[model samples]
Target: MWQKHNPARELRSLLSRIETVSQPQVGLVADVLEHACPRLKSTLGPNALVRRLIEAEAWVDLGFWLIGWELPDWAVHRLSCDDSRWSCAICVRGLALNWVEDVAEFQHEDPALAILGAFVQAQVRKAQGHGPSNVTIFRRVERSGAVSMGPEVER
Candidate 1:
């Protein structure tokens, strides 16, 4: 007889892969920003805006854990369990990165926050069986950045 498939075990395996990437560090951040933005090639012209947008995106990915989020197929699967047409956190982040053009554009008003908030709210609700719908996931993501800096706050 064939063995039964276990959802939790599958989820664990997926989470492990998502978490295994080395944490984003300063050197890696610099390299990604330089490569994606290419400051030297940009001048005071139309390409300057495009370069700025690319740099902002690279910063968001490195400054946040967007790349790790992107790598996990499981995360996407989990979030879209109810509806196949829905986009997950990773996709939302990519969309946000593309939308953001500069540092000033990186704020709560950004659409990235809205997408992240919805995704996080869904996860929290799934985990707790119930939770506030309006809770912002950016708070948790921002907390992760603080934790990386060695000073974590109590939630």
Candidate 2:
């Protein structure tokens, strides 16, 4: 939609800006994505922008934790139940990853948009890749006193 509707030209007219791919940090990338997600979904459909981002390997570069999922109605049902597969945060994260179609879908491309969509739900909502830097998951929380919820949970 940006390309068709002339995002560059419009930006040039409106803000006199030029696009640059150099030296973009995760915080910078995240700020743009989070704020633009609503408009992106409106303009390109939810999956389209995500698909583009994944194809560009945006997340790998950003090392950002995902948040803010505009979940599908069906997914909301699965995640809402306490007796659900999503009850344990770790378990839910795993479940969401599988649902996202990690492998390539022949017609589409690599990584799959649904996978990114699931990440959109599971990072803070999801976390992927083999890179190590920031981001941490507290795998276990040991309630020190009598307020324990049974045992230490592995996130």
Candidate 3:
């Protein structure tokens, strides 16, 4: 069966491969970044930017650069462990006028890869309309210890 493509799974595989390589090539990383964030299509300097960052071996900076294109407003990353794993968190600005107050997290041994994964995950969720602002979430109430559907609410 031909299954649909899932960006999250693809990101995991890409990051895993990157981890084994001593130095990930610019072309591969750049291609992945472009595929991950299509919004960057409006810009003409991505390739050059990728080359510079890769040459500098600036993984964290690459992550931030990607985030700037995706969620230009705000994003953050943190070192989750001393083993060099990094966790990235981002605020998804939904289609609604107000922010949905949702956060998606992704981790990787390389900070850039971690942020890249988070970017892909967040973008996928947003596109699928996963947040409360985009979809109506069904609530459940307990009646005699039995769960029943309650009013639909927007988180």
TM-score: which is higher, 2 or 3? 3
Candidate 1 C-alpha error for residue 53, in Å: 14
The list of candidate 1 runs beyond 4 A from truth reads: 1-108, 129-155
| Candidate 1 overall lDDT versus native | 0.32
Candidate 2 has a TM-score of 0.19
Q: Please write out the lDDT profile of model 1 over residues 1-155, one tens digit for every residue.
A: 98776433443333333233333334433433333222223544534543454466543333234223322211222223233232234232222233222001111223333233333333333334332222233322355355343334455
Please report, in order, the local distance difference test score of every candidate based on alpha carbons.
Answer: 0.32, 0.32, 0.63
- Candidate RMSDs in order: 20.8, 17.1, 13.1
Which candidate do you rate higher for TM-score, 1 or 3?
Answer: 3
Candidate 2 structure quality by residue, lDDT tens digits, 1-155: 33565432332221111122323334434544543244344654556655566568676322222322332111221212233112211123323345444221111121222223233333222123311223233344445553543445555
What root-mean-square deviation over C-alphas does model 2 reach? 17.1
Query: How do all the candidates rank in terms of TM-score, highest first?
Result: 3, 1, 2
Best by the TM-score measure: 3
